[model samples]
Target: MMAPFSHTATGKKAAMALRSQLAQGAKFLLGLWMAGVIVAMFVIIPQYEGLGDAGRIIIMHVPTAWVTSLAFVVSGVFSALYLFRRRVSDDASAVAAAEVGFLFCILATATGAIFAQIVWGVFWNWDPRETSILVLLLIYAAYFALRSAIDDDNRKRRLGAVYNLFAAVTMPFLLFVAPRLADSSLHPNCAFIQGSQCDGITLELSGARIGLLGDSKLELKSLERQGDLVVADVNVTRPGYQVENHRPSFDLASGKPADRPEFDGEQFMLAVEQVDLATGTARLNIEAPGSGLLGNSRTLLTFFASMIGFTALFVWLYRLRAQLLMGEEWLAQRERTYGFPS
Candidate 1:
């Protein structure tokens, strides 16, 4: 029969071997997932009107935010389990999720700031959505501080559970409710309201439609103030339609619409008029008959790609954290058994 020490050593060796195998599998899966993410960036993301190249950033930024919220949810759920079962492993799971979630929250905020800078021409505006996300980060950070302040394991776990439960209660209100309290927000939200009506509006030159495809005549004249007026006459074979003066006007091509129709004259004359008016000249795009554009399914692909990639990455990190916590517990137990520091 095996001695007690010998049996214990064998069990440890078996556990380590199993862990090594799992780690290798995780590494392989992560590599494959990353490959797909790259493919989405290069081959799948599409250029749709105003959201052309810059739209690529949308995938990463949104995912980071989503992952943050998901992490908090996980932390809360694990905290609840720890309270109900009083398991040390459950407490470890809750902490791991909270820490990783906080990291994801920071990433989401930073990425969003970068995107906002590019699109809105500013960074760190106190937009309603921004405020909510910022508050969430603070809450998660506080959870960590709370955990650190307590040295007793049982007490810490109990208090942590209660704190996380309170924190979870606030998430829906802060993230979903608070932002929508304003009349309008730069943030995106999907509302399923009863009796909602769409505000009918014409699509602009820089909206949902794709690029202008046609021949154009360009005339540029230099002005005295080192500025110039450009008049371009473009003909589109197929035009998008808009109701102007209650009449369906076919825009074979279109440029940025003026606050009002700035010109009802020749393109060159309008450009000259714009120069004197000190208003920028608008390029004239004349659509022929039926050429408003739509996307080529690339936008959908990009959405899925970014969503899947970010979710996979978040799961990987969360799992890794949990595993490390488990390893720490194992080492602590081993130290006690061996009567030595590991």
Candidate 2:
């Protein structure tokens, strides 16, 4: 026979006290970390002059991506634990992580689109990286929808674990390996987007080049025969444009040399070499892009701190769940052995 709610006051109080302790511990740490994030936003970031407008997006985008990745990983682990221990809390944690992962993934995709607009000139470029991430979002959405469709707890946990494991395996392949198979329309083929290559010079754009200053001169052959340095003569059919090899060329509008007003290493300067946009041909150069506050060290530290704090909170919750399960099992055994009133 089921007892009245009032009959369980003692048990209820103990549960409430345990919950209060967990909540207090989590809330205090979470509140402190959130305060840090706010301070980083208003105080720390604005102090950097170079970040300007794009700096704000980093506060949003990077954390979201990190959390999204972390959440999915945690969900997969919890899903596997559910299959082993048959614990209800493990299933709950899996569900909670999945939900949070979905939310963070949404933020990641949206903020990434915003960043791409500012950096790459287009909001949605259908780049391979972007496409892979979108597919991951859809795949998790389907995972959640499947969970909702099931009513039985055991069956739900089993099926969800299977899917989560499959996703965990496939995600690495999609995010890490799949993008390398083809030429990227967006950012240059770097190590993160492309597979590793040997030490021999790896030029990304074979037919396209960009110079910091001056008009790009187009294709020509090397005049020097088998030597350390080769001189390539570029003919300028276009009027009013000067074409000189190795030496700095002048711009008609501005009297200053057309090359960058900074340091001139052979490799660095060579990257921004002769291009003929008219003929749609040129060679590639490997040079670092301009710097901004978004890439600063201090900003990255604060971002990482917030993410670590968030992960710690989840870790604490996981521990709390284990304690609660132990308490529940102990109480069940006591009731059975003592023949306590049900």
TM-score for each of the candidates: 0.63, 0.57
Candidate 2 per-residue C-alpha lDDT over 1-342 given as tens digits, one digit per residue, 9 for 90 to 100: 456666688789999999999988878978788788868866775543322466456566656767777777888898889889988777777767777777777887898787677656578978786888889988988888887799875687789888987776666665656655533233333411224310112112333232222233333332221222223333322124454344222233432224322123211233323333335333333222212233456676776776676566555654555566556756776987999934
TM-score of 2: 0.57
Candidate 2 regions exceeding 4 Å error are 1-26, 46-51, 180-182, 185-295, 310-342
Highest TM-score: give the candidate number: 1
For all predictions, the C-alpha RMSD in Å is 13.1, 11.8
The model with the greatest lDDT is 1
Assess candidate 1 and give its TM-score to the true structure. 0.63
Which 10-residue window of candidate 1 scores lowest in summed lDDT?
191-200
Candidate 1 local lDDT, 94-163, one digit each (tens): 8888888889888888877876676556788798878888998898789989988998867988999999
